[model samples]
Target: MMGNRRPFKAAIIEFNPCLNNLNDNIKHLLKEVTEAAEKGAKLIVTPEMATTGYHYENRRALKPYIDTIPGKTTAAFEKVAKHYQTHIVIGMAEVDVEDGLYYNSAVLIGPDGYIGKYRKIHQWATENSWASWGDMGVPVYETEIGNISMIICMDASYFESARIAAVNGADILCFPTNSTGGSLSMLQAWAEMNGLYVLGANRSNTEKGYHMIGASTVWSPNGEKLAETSYIEEEKTRNETTIIYAEIDPAEYDNRSKRRLQSRQPDLYGDLMLHIGPWDFTKYELIKEAEDVQGNEMSNCAALLQYTPVIGDKKANLSKIKSLLKDTAAETKPKKGLLSLVVCPELSLTGPVHSLELTAIQQLGETDHDETVNEMQKLACMYQTHLVFGMIESDSHALYNTVMLLTPAGDIAAKARKLHVTESDERWATPGKDIVVTSTKGVGRVGLMVGYDAAFPETAGVMAVNHADFIIVPSCWHGDYGKEMALHTKMMENKYPTNTMTTWDAMARFAQAKTLIANFTGTKLGCRGGSAIYTLDPIYGGETPIVASSDKEEVLVVAIAQTEKDCWFDQNKLLLSRRTHYYRPLVKKFEHVPMLDCN
Candidate 1:
């Protein structure tokens, strides 16, 4: 479709591209991509990893599967692309030279030749074993048809990934998916909220114990199910692939939304850098930081945290908290640490002092989403720090554990609901089931953190491993087994490549930042302590802390130099890396999680 108004002719190829069976996959892709293009689809989309099916268990096992464009897949597609004189967005398993690990990349080919490729920045399931994560952003390529950005299956789930693409002016978010039946509804809704035309092309078949529900479709800017692979229709013709044609126009996007870009506020989110690349030098300072008693000349960075009572009364608590923060802020103006931050423990505003706090809960307890969110923005701006705090989430239900990030510039960058609901957490909260990332010019991109979230190492580690500076964990610590030991295990197991580091100091030692675990100190219940500021090197193991304050409100400032993140090769040597060309890489894997309409 050209626009919601124009009835333009187009085709949607529900490509059942052979996974692992490259020769056949190409034979199929070449035929369909060309046929669809010739059938008058200015833009044609295919299923995820259409050229090569997703497959892989180990690096060595995957070596035989990987290949670059033009090797076999591209050579075949090039003819289709040129001869048809159309633009095509298709997925393939690629070998990045650095680590030798394969990448799920969607290469954009214009009629003239190959354009840039948008690598899948995110992955699913055992995908990490064979393919490393991609580093580039969701990019929209210009073509005669219109402006389009290609997004792989899972990548579309994250709001950050798509928002960035839209911010770059993508008229259509064309996704090549391989998903199960259950997830279809959610993806359709996503298209409507952003006023985007989502061309989600999913595959059908089984691989690595997973099978997809093939119903590729086109979603209009208003989210109308424009075209889907109708099983009934295909069955009649014995056709597996369905062609969905639609018209898209640049004007369908929300004009009001551009206000965010015209007034892009990067300054307020400066300290939010710890949200993305974890390896800033500042995060290391929090391990055991205290002002130079003798004025030993502190580092240029200040690691700051929210002030809380150390098991005391209101006045006594306020006095102590004020002194510590005031002193920290003055001593370290603009904070020595480049990554400035302040994390509020779950219920930081008022200690979990008593259950009565719940009665007063309506003020901003677990159930007060709107009010709490509003207050957080106010609190963050006043504090002049990149403030990320935890509080009880309130909705129709009693409560749910949740976290919110209030950028210093007074914007809400991102938020996360606790996925791992514990007894106490469940006592007042519902398990949060979504992932969000906020883009900031300062530290780059940061994300929200909730307590017990660290318990799902895969959830946290995968997010961190993919894209995130640091996770701002917000929760109250209880009786010591070292009660938080479970949290440590979760962190260790899910950290990355392999769960290598264990403790804050351990993470500090490994990743070069205490802030990675910088927020809290010695685990204690019935008392508030351990609030911190810090950074983690790109690798999860290298953690370090810059400045830390226990039970106090303070402005921990950071002055970080924008740094380049490490590529896959920096860690995995090619010989040991899993290159898809060398072996068969597993196609995408995952049963999509259910999420409410969080537009």
Candidate 2:
């Protein structure tokens, strides 16, 4: 797809449709599209439901605005697309005359006329009252500008909708949304995670009681904010139309998609298709609460110990681990019928393998019955707390980077090998082949993931689909990596000041699970401690308070209750709303596609 073609310009229109006035809305959209096309924008997109207002009470209230795909809206936009020799994507309310059903849809038109259409597959709460679930699967259209795909507002909340399009060879994703706060972060994550350009066109002004937050944005494949609009309420209430533009060169980001696709392990993602509702935990009794537990009981406490370990020094690292465990136990008194989980960074037992030789690294590996495990088991039993930490495991003729969960019963509850090994681990470690999730007495089901595995969404998605209440990541994430560096530069340039922590938070929110991340501090391998517990607010999405984070050694603890989990599942049925049938491409075997340059 990347030839000698030059970079092409794309535009997004932040529109405010007049309620029950289809004529006025269409006229406004046409004027904006024509203006963008006149300015040499090869592609232009509008906000979702651009022909009709977003919030209607029921089908009867929205009935007047419903029309066929090529009936009037597409016909109006087609003239502009053909006149300027460009492509246009517009969102509208569609009615299937054959069945008399309604849908929230996005239609694409080029110089040749109507290209294709995509309905809102994942509907928001209000949309369920009138619109039918999208029957059309994700579609990508071929054009001279790029291979383009469209997703409505709520569809961007789930990674699967965008992942499927990327896997099918989509270079750019057009997002037509009416979402408010926290949408910018979601768009950036989607763009970086799938390695594709994302153009978000969000509406302005208030519809009914729903106030649109107008931060229409353009994001590059590396998660850089190429362009964006105002999110101020005062500005949005003016109902002013805004147009933003960006120049995209698909060739520059070809390697990112190549590496992302090449690193995927689809065989481990079968659980994604399972219909696992959140309430299924109760039926399965995944988290066995104590019999004496009261309805208003305080939540269990979890802690993260962030510290740099000496390379190849197992004795010092193990001693430091014991000291930290002892101090934390003394501070936060462990109570009966309550759970206490403590996590440490990756390879906390034997330190990182940065400058160590293969033979030296192998010698640092510990077995199940080694003194290192014995000492940790003693600490777990003595403190009456569940302990999670990473270590280099020595097996028969092989060494693996492994995370072990030691229950308060003085036994190894679960051990997971790193599934996605990094460059350092590749020198002396073998990649794990499966995802691990285990049911603890008080923590519900706990999923285990090592450092690099957190970078892949499928690892966490599989666990959440299998009903994991909490996901623990033992990471040694560095700031010097190429992708991380790019993202950091972009965040600073935009005054956002976020890091890879947003990635972890986004994964937790999409999975509807709480995530506890433990990372090493100090300069070893450029790892700066950012260990924190990420929580989900059903109304506000992922929120990272960063309970305890620093560039130095520290012990961070936070109380997590069952109420939060219950509230999330009760209010937001995110897991139950998944359209699994359309996720088949995610689990398919990988093959090189040179034309798409994803090898």
Best by lDDT: 2
Q: Indicate the TM-score of model 1.
A: 0.46
Error of 2 at 196 (Å): 1.3
What root-mean-square deviation over C-alphas does model 2 reach?
3.8
What tens digits encode model 2's per-residue C-alpha lDDT throughout 1-599? 33325788889999888989888899988999999999999889899999888887799999888889878888888899999988899999999879989999999999879999999988988889999999877887777777889989888767788888888778889989987654444777778777889999987688876777777888888777889887647343848799999998866447454366767889988998877565575543543442222243465777788888887787898888878877777777754234478898999877678688878887788799997788788878887889998888989878899999999887999999998787778899999988998888766678999988877788888887766778999888774221321221222212322333556766777777788889888864577777877666423432434545447788777665544544423213766888888888889886665554423
What do the candidate models score in CA lDDT, each in turn?
A: 0.51, 0.78
lDDT of 1 by residue, 128-186 (tens): 78777776666767665556787777564343455456556666787877765322424
Q: Which stretches of candidate 1 lie over 4 Å from their true place?
A: 1-8, 97-99, 181-186, 231-239, 250-272, 276-599
Worst 10 residues of 1 by lDDT: 480-489
Which 10 consecutive residues of model 2 have the lowest summed lDDT?
A: 485-494
Task: State candidate 2's TM-score.
Answer: 0.91
